[model samples]
Target chain A: MNDGTSATVTEIDMRNTSLRDLNRQLHEATSGHFVVTNPRGAHAVAAGIDSDIVVELRGSVGYYAAGMLQRGTVIVDGNAGTGVAENMMSGVARVTGSATMSAGATGCGGLLVIEGGAGARCGISMKGLDIVVGGDIGHMGAFMAQAGNLVVLGDADHHLGDSIYEADLFVRGDVASLGADCEEKEMSAEDVDLLTQLLERAQMTADPGDFRHFGSARQLYNFHPDDINSEVAEARS
Target chain B: MTGENWHQRESYTFDRNVIAEIHRAANTGIYRIRGFGAKRRLPTFDDLVFLGASMSRYPLEGYREDCGTDVIIGEGRAERPVHLDIPITIAGMSFGSLSAQAKEALGRGANAAGTSTTTGDGGMTPEERGHSKTLVYQYLPSRYGMNPDDIRKADAIEVVVGQGAKPGGGGMLLGQKITERVAEMRTLPEGIDQRSACRHPDWTGPDDLEIKILELREIVGWQVPVYVKIGAARPFYDTALAVKAGADAVVVDGMQGGTAATQDVFIEHVGIPTIAAVPEAVRAMKELGAHRDVKLIVAGGIRTGADVAKALALGADAVSLGTAALIAIGDNSPSLEDQYQALGTTAGCWEDYQDGTDPAGITTQDPELSARLDPVVAGRRLANYLQVLTLEVQTLARANGKSHVHNLEPDDLAALTVEAAAMAKVPLAGTSWIPGMG
Candidate 1:
């Protein structure tokens, strides 16, 4: 629901302008489909972006691109650096290329879709954000992830889902190792359906059956005196 | 043996507390984690005496005189620097260690007192943001709840390099205090011990820190002031470095500063006393030709208005409060003596914040315990305490024959102890003898 009609497009050349001035202009300009040309891997290119508008950045961007976006859609045509869509409240931050570390980190509500691979700690400590990575994710990808769905259609790296909380993981590839307190769980029909929906949202062709679910067993959620007893009992059995 | 009464008791070097600590360490096989500041005695503001106007100068009327107590920090650097009615500010205390209600109380109290409240390690909370007139968001090592939106919402950004209790060490939020909300905010599991990293992930040195500072300014449109906070171990060097890195204000927290949880060894072993730190920080700024240019805000163990006066006299622009603010909000009240005894501690000696069983509801995350502290009442109490502190400072300023509190210089002070005189770099009472004079 931008002030400018979907037919109209506003083009901005970012070569001469400073990042602060560019972001300020975006914040001040009420609403529009802003087309940014020649980003050239600039950091926080459209950071703290608010307003119900669409931003189409032409090329690769540096760290914190589209960070803290609220009620808008940011489509990065190329690769994104660290902390893409970080702490986003509500919106869509879609990167057509791969992303660096901590993508969608601490995001409460949003849809972050990466069409390619993601670097280390991809969804670390996510909160209620759905992150869809079309390719592999690096080591400790979902470490301490609290909530939300992390869907990876390709492979995942070492120590996946280490010390994760209530966040659900859907992976379709082999993992190297697992971290403490994380466990693989059986994927139900509901899990497949969710994966199917996410894949469709990311505009990718992938089989839902190829995905496996991972989550926390919640055993280490609380400290108890009877923990030793449970461990000993399992050992005996 | 023949004269039992004549025999000296246990050696002072190996006191009961020392012996107990040895035994406790032997049994636990781990360092003791606790809250509060150093329990041992050290030279402090108590060792400093004021030269009340007596002979040559005349004392202003306590009730009628116009003694200014207002201070302006970040005067020129920031597009909008906070103009405080009083020099005392509420220091950073995390939401995880403290209840949301407690954080809200700090905000309300600071707002009422016309001072800024800091958002501590865990990130900014909505309650704090909504209640506080001026909120300083901490960019800590952990980056737990860091977001550009919250950063933009903040009035200031304090890049936390170190804390007073554990200068080189990171912070800890024990599992018992990590409730659902805290866990979600930190992106850790509920009821799991969260250990913050000691160093920032992006930058390793001061040169890199300079870049990080610029990046932060870029994020906020260069409107809010950037503050750099460091423990008071190397105040002279650290203050100079922070200024070089483009900080509008520098916060130097002394060793007596309180913490939510840290090793007992670290609390007592690290950092310098507040009495010593203020002068060093001031000296650094003065040497670098940025004395008043970059505002110096000191913290740690500041309780009384006289302490505030002494700090200002020693060249601190402002003072921040942590433990004293919590006490004002009803932590460790003598009324909770029964509860303290039940928890195997005394009222004023309570320090087990890691256990999450705070009787005063100021530290715990329990719903019932947290609800016990009403934000409105606590805020009013804090405001009342701040008013007294401001009035006392004004009274001292009037007595010193100075129109403004900042006008009271080191000349107005005299030390009562050799250690205090040496540490504070001030002359002894009725004598020109300054112990550490160069």
Candidate 2:
């Protein structure tokens, strides 16, 4: 296991090493900086990492790359497939290129950074995750997002933060449309600080003032007695 | 002058129960939402009876003979497959739906029975995880309270596609049941009627499910078995697809399976019967040439030892229990008659599990109500019930000249009804005729 830059480096060539073997070796290591070469768009390239290690993948990865990551740093030099860094607990997952749908979906805790554009349903059902997207995101981004901070430097697609609860969403560029129970809220000082930290951590050039904050309107949280009455009236009409 | 001499006739078109339901709906302008499975009569295991040994076959002594009930699920695949002393397991019921004491009791009872108990949609609670010896973590659509550490602690993983109570529908935890703890775990506001998603956010259908299963296996290092569970909507194709999706085992829950809360219409009218589901699932597995290679666990309406034996005879590797286990743990107990009446229901007909005012304290979240159910006593009762079921299965197997419970086959059974004969692929009791067989 490599300790620092000067220590012995661990390199795994996916051409020779099996996925299971590679993950097994990674899981066994406590502290190391490993470089993965020739990934060839394989799924689960560096998944279930529970230690404080560094995993750098040279090529594009398939579905669920860096999935269920606990405590580690995952850097993907190329594009990622669906659910990149999905369900990660505590870690730092950075993708240099674009990612497919549901990036960081249902993640409990982690920092997910996508340098390029992301597909639809990005950060869906995100719980306590911090996401910073440098490029534009597709439709249904952060739908039903529970608790998290999503900072987008570029334009966002339609239905951003649909049915959101307690999560803070900030977008720099134009938002196509807001979804149900989502509305633009006045940005606070704390929100600005949070955005500044996330942007600085992601190393993306964007000012906190350039973005607008959006969050839950708290309308769809509970079922009121009037809701049923209105629904019944609508049905009859 | 007496009521008996009044000569009142009930209408066949609209029965009293049906009329009452309509009246209730008209008053509320909403459909009836309740718990429990279908209350209507359906073709069940009671329609088929095992043929005891006659002059053709010699019977073993019931008390002395040893009829084995052990089952090993996910053999040859997982590093640590689930090994059960009995074939019966406790089905998945969420912590948000059931009280902590009830979840603990289920785990404790399953432990005593030397079987496995599964965690449900709301994720694994510390009470259940600590109490259960063998636990199967359910990976559901909502992904509520899902933690990778809990997944690592599980003995097995169950990817829940659907439940039998409502096949195409999702789960519902009403506002009353969503307490502070429940809300915190689900990452939602308190007192919200949480409607869980019907499909996974990242994946859809079998092809994507295969990849999802791979990710799950990778998370756990392929140490434990992974089972895919499906509601009995399309048993044959669902089973085939689940097998093709690389499941170590398949759990098929039929129409009679219980739910914590669902629309009455969906519960009663959604899926096929348990007796019909088993044969079709077995057929699919047999055709895939993975009949015993991939184990099958059947659920829904499995109440007695006879039901367990019947499921095995129809080619199920094991069976799971939800409603019956709750009953054993004091749900709908006759002792709570006064309380049940106060809630506008009878002891045997208590189906207001969604309201969360359960008299027996098994379903409610109220501290005072939840305190009434003693976990130790309830667990012992469930253990006793499981023991009785196992004994009865062994007795039937021995009487049928079988050395093991799994050895009981369809040839050793006969149907009491034409519908049963056709569905079960068995001969009629007195006649040598099966409806579709030439």
Candidate 3:
């Protein structure tokens, strides 16, 4: 087992060993992709990895497939379970298939790409990261995004970009309604170029021309007494 | 209008010459005031905590014998959880609001009592950190005096989301109190009104707060425990979120808490009472399956030992004191009645912390006024009060068959009045009434 004292790659056969042993081996291995084949559904397969290594899970995995990843690439070949790629930082996490709700919730920085659909609150409160979802995202996507870029090829759910600030959003499909302080902005050539690069990085073939951008209008930063009085008066009326 | 009432109301009138003479007797400089300064009858935090041991309950020996009062906060998960010798900790009252001597005195008292003192919105002061054995460094939304060096130096980190005195509101320090040093610490212009941002500059909700926590952990290499301090609003949701965000402990401050300077309207009408907030926070911890695993520190209106015992019985791991600690260090004492009167207010009833007209020298920048307070004597008084509180809590705990003060449960408590019972979430007298019971 690599206990942070050594920098070496140690491989183990997933067929002969359990998911727990595989994860342990992967955690111990230094800076290389540990290939896994025919992996049955397993929970917490690769949790708390803090090294620059890659783990390629060949088959579908259970809940929290790549939870609390600090650095490294964790690629799930098939569909993943709940909290897939949760709180990942400074690495590329590419999920080939659909992910459950709360995907990439509170990710500080890193590139998380979902080839298939993602459930509710995708990229919620994403800070300084780039999330590219090829398929549609469920409700409350990019809610309270402080700073990041969320590019969705398909339609976005309700309350998209709620209470967002400075974060860039590009979606090709219909947006139900923009959240408070979030307004639609004209997409420029520079924006198109950025989208093209993001798509290439995420390994998606979506057209940048079809996408629309949304961002914060910068209201509600400071409260005004007149606004509160008006609201109270309206309630009274 | 009655004849008998009219006869009883017969009065004498003073001579016009005598009135003129009295008016002429009044001096022009600092002598025109009638009463003490700031005579408003505002309620302090101590007004809420009534002593519990009266006639029915058994009380322990005040001296000799052991009534343990030590507390382990942020244990297990926090990189550095503080182990205090006493339950009563000093609250975060800023350096700008109080003089350097006052801060030093508070630290000295807390150190003597084997507890910790907190740094406030202005940031860590050398006097506070030097005197305090255990010091809690506060990380406010403003990021004032925030750096990696201070984070590493702190015994614990308290992320202040809000305070009970003004839950949804930010802080405002007027120009009068912002000394050069205070201005330097907060990175603001000297002698100008400073308003701290209510929301955090870097993070939003608990979801993003996790990242901030991780960053702090990385910076400090996870040596000290992280505590999330929130004003008592929706205690259930806030507490649950704090725990979910990987906090080692949660500090829940109730409405009656004192502020160095806040609007009177916000202080009187902003948040829930301290007595009501404790049980709700305890319930939230229980719901998250982190009741005792994650420590709960309750504040606001915590005064004497009986109040400490009652709070512990109601499921608080420990209690913190601010105004009471200040009082023990000679704030609003009757001895300062002359100075208070000169300022048009009375001792034991002053709240003009926003104005720099303090007489006891505790909360002013004027060198002469601040020099009136002796840090060594004030520190001794505060230590004595802390000792009393520890003994009092221990006495009640022993009577209830609890070896340690933390072991006192709700069963050991009974409310005197319906209001007290409802507020404390305990059973009424001569009845089995538990609010959290399913």
Candidate 4:
């Protein structure tokens, strides 16, 4: 049906739907197998998809998959490339396998769940997204997160929540070290509740009691050389 | 030791003789002069604007009134949209010409003013990006730091065709400023003089430029607005071409604009004055039926609120500062008089930007010179200058019985001289005399 507003679900599968075509169809269509096959590390797969539609990728996807997504469910059957669900405003992006670097980076609002480990710079500059990883994440995870909940099940690499601002970070394993402006804060009951909720949303089985919260120390934003020098002197002392 | 002292003294005398000879040769047309053009004589773009107060335009009661200077360029439909709080912005002074510290100071100042600063022929720096809330990345013909990631990171993209100081000429970053990092960003050999290509490598004309814009828009996903910046030559044609090429805004830089390095002949002789360019650009936009719809930003000899008001009145949506912003950040502060003397120049009046011998550490690559400037303090000074400019513009607008600065019209302007009247295309003061007409 060539109606201005509607398209058939079968129409998507019949054509050699490129990533651009699929994205355009997803933007225009209300419901659609929307099968994206032959995805040879294609980027921005299912990007700008707003409607309540389901998109299935037959193979691995590339960077910024489902970027800036809103109000839809995106299911990736295989491993996802870098920046999966980046800057996503709202919706659910579920990856069945491991994710590459910068998963859910700068996602303002959404639920992103990675079943396996994420690469370096995971959730770097994340603003207000809920990221749950089932396995170990690489170094510099949750860097500069202003406001969001990041739940990691495995050991985090060095500089977790580096220079972060206000985003709640809950990690189950050992952290190598905190970056500048990031500090380890004791987990409270409310934090545990939030962690538990994130776990349940990601369908994770990890216990919330094993997690620790990390946040910004509120330093670096206001720079006073004298205060910094004194702190440096105190460290020497 | 005596012999060494004798040799040192002799060498000093010899060096002075050589310099004198060089100067003589330059004046006599023996040695071909290259770079350091417009900086030789007359007041720079920084000299005209002086901060005025309640006596001239109603000065803000300091903390009582809300004087807003925030402006958003290339917003809504362009490839990249930049949201800035202040109207004053740093003009494009390339990376190869300025030290990293100078660029950083520019960013710090612009950021403090809640405005955006631009990257020059050099690529984007982490320090500049981190400091600035909104950064407009330059896409010059040289493509020094042209990469998809930097373009995506930028709040707005400026496609620079030419500069006011030296139109149709390439940029040269001397070997002195070509530090390891600058070389790396530009992909040039370290310790070697780098010359940027005069024309863009990817595109040649407006038709191709439109495609290039589309490519950039596609890569950045059309979030940030794209601005096409041109030197004020053929303002009507260039402005129309830029608008036709899908530029969200067109920035017209006049002959009075500053450059880090350019041949003396080109700076003084080439390009039209900003006063003349503004009206032509606005006329082009009006003819295209996109006068205010597509933003027109004018830069060249824009110093004070009066100059800014004049530009807006003649049809510029906003004004950008290069030399003036640099001065506000302590480019030639009188406190560095001793250093200026040592450089054989005076503070508040040095223009040998090409020699890489700036005393304020603004235009030099020398580590000792660069370390003189502190980015934090410089940024604060720039913020103060921007605040003063906003207040002055607001005051002038009030005097003209206008609410917003953008509401000012050509009716508010009266040219002081016949030349100014002809050049500005406005009526003469105390008369109905309009130049270029009987």
Ranking by TM-score: 2, 1, 3, 4
Provide TM-scores for the models. Answer: 0.83, 0.94, 0.61, 0.61
Which residues of candidate 2, in runs, are more than 4 Å off? A1-7, A225-237, B1-11, B436-438
Worst 10 residues of 2 chain B by lDDT: B1-10
What's model 2's lDDT at B375? 95
- Expressed as tens digits, the lDDT of each residue in A93-179 for candidate 3 is 888988766677656568888899988778765655788998999887876665678999999989898767567999999998888
- Model 3 DockQ reads 0.03
> Of the candidates numbered 2 and 3, which has the greater TM-score value?
2
lDDT of 1 at A97: 94
Question: Measured with DockQ on alpha carbons, how good is candidate 1?
Answer: 0.22
Q: Provide C-alpha RMSD values for all models, in order.
A: 4.7, 3.4, 10.8, 16.5
lDDT of 2 by residue, A1-237 (tens): 444445356899999998988888888878878999999999988899998889999999999999989999999999999999998898899999999999999888989999998999899989899999999999999988889888888999999998888788999999999989999999999988988999998899988999999999999876544345567789999
lDDT per residue as tens, model 3, B83-117 = 99887788887788888888989999998899999
CAPRI classification of candidate 3? incorrect
| Model 3 alpha-carbon miss at residue B321, Å | 1.1
Error (Å) of candidate 1 at residue B118 is 3.0
The best candidate in terms of TM-score? 2
Each candidate's iRMS in angstroms? Answer: 4.6, 2.6, 12.2, 15.8
TM-score of chain A of each: 0.91, 0.93, 0.84, 0.88
**Which candidate number has the best DockQ?**
2
lDDT over C-alpha atoms for residue A237 of model 1: 100
